[model samples]
Target: MEKFSFDGPPVGDDADISAECQRQLLSPIQEIVKAAVAAGWSRQDVLLAMVELSWDMYEKRRGDL
Candidate 1:
């Protein structure tokens, strides 16, 4: 995985932040899907798991705010 530093000025606007967040989020999901596939999970199973995980995270973060 590549390391990203944001120690300087803002990368751009809200769109840029959203894009970066998405890229960072999907990077881990891609890895999880690959590992799950290798471990005998179907593509649909992996996708369902991803959806559930995303919703769980969203709910948790929403509560934190």
Candidate 2:
């Protein structure tokens, strides 16, 4: 698989920050997911765990912001 890369928003461009952030994050995230699957972890389980952990983190951190 090719490594993901993002050039980022152009100078003075008002790109969607959330989308840009996701693009930047995808490369490492994909690497981790692929590695986890290769190491005998089922994709469904890994994805479900990610969703559960992410939701928990979001809920915990929501109060801070």
Candidate 3:
């Protein structure tokens, strides 16, 4: 497993730019997802795993430690 931080445009400035930044950040994930599927993991399984991992990151960002 690998951990990384994604820092993008600040919150609540411009919606279009914010959305575009999000799209760019998430774009690379598609290739990794395809690789995961090729490695025999179901799409749903991979999605769920990502969701769980995102929640952990969210919690930590929220200072839940």
Q: Say which candidate scores most in lDDT.
A: 2
Better of 2 and 3 by TM-score: 2
Best prediction by TM-score: 2
Write the residue-wise lDDT of candidate 2 on 1-65 in tens digits: 76566776635567587787877887787787899999999988988998899899999999999
Looking at model 2, residue 51 earns an lDDT score of: 87
- What are the per-residue Cα lDDT tens digits for candidate 1 across 1-65? 65654433336454476666676667667877888999999989999987899899999899789
Better by lDDT, candidate 2 or 1? 2
CA lDDT of 44 in candidate 3?
88
Q: Residue 61 error for model 3, in Å?
A: 1.8
Residue pairs whose backbone atoms clash in candidate 2: none
Model 2 / residue 22 / CA error / Å? 1.0
Q: Tell me the spans in candidate 2 whose CA falls farther than 4 Å from its real position.
A: 1-13
lDDT of each: 0.76, 0.83, 0.78
- For candidate 1, the TM-score is 0.62
lDDT of 1 at 5: 45
lDDT of 3: 0.78
Name the candidate, 1 or 2, with the larger TM-score value. Answer: 2
Question: In candidate 1, which residue pairs clash?
Answer: none
Name the lDDT value of residue 16 in candidate 3: 79
Worst-scoring 10-residue span by lDDT in model 3? 6-15
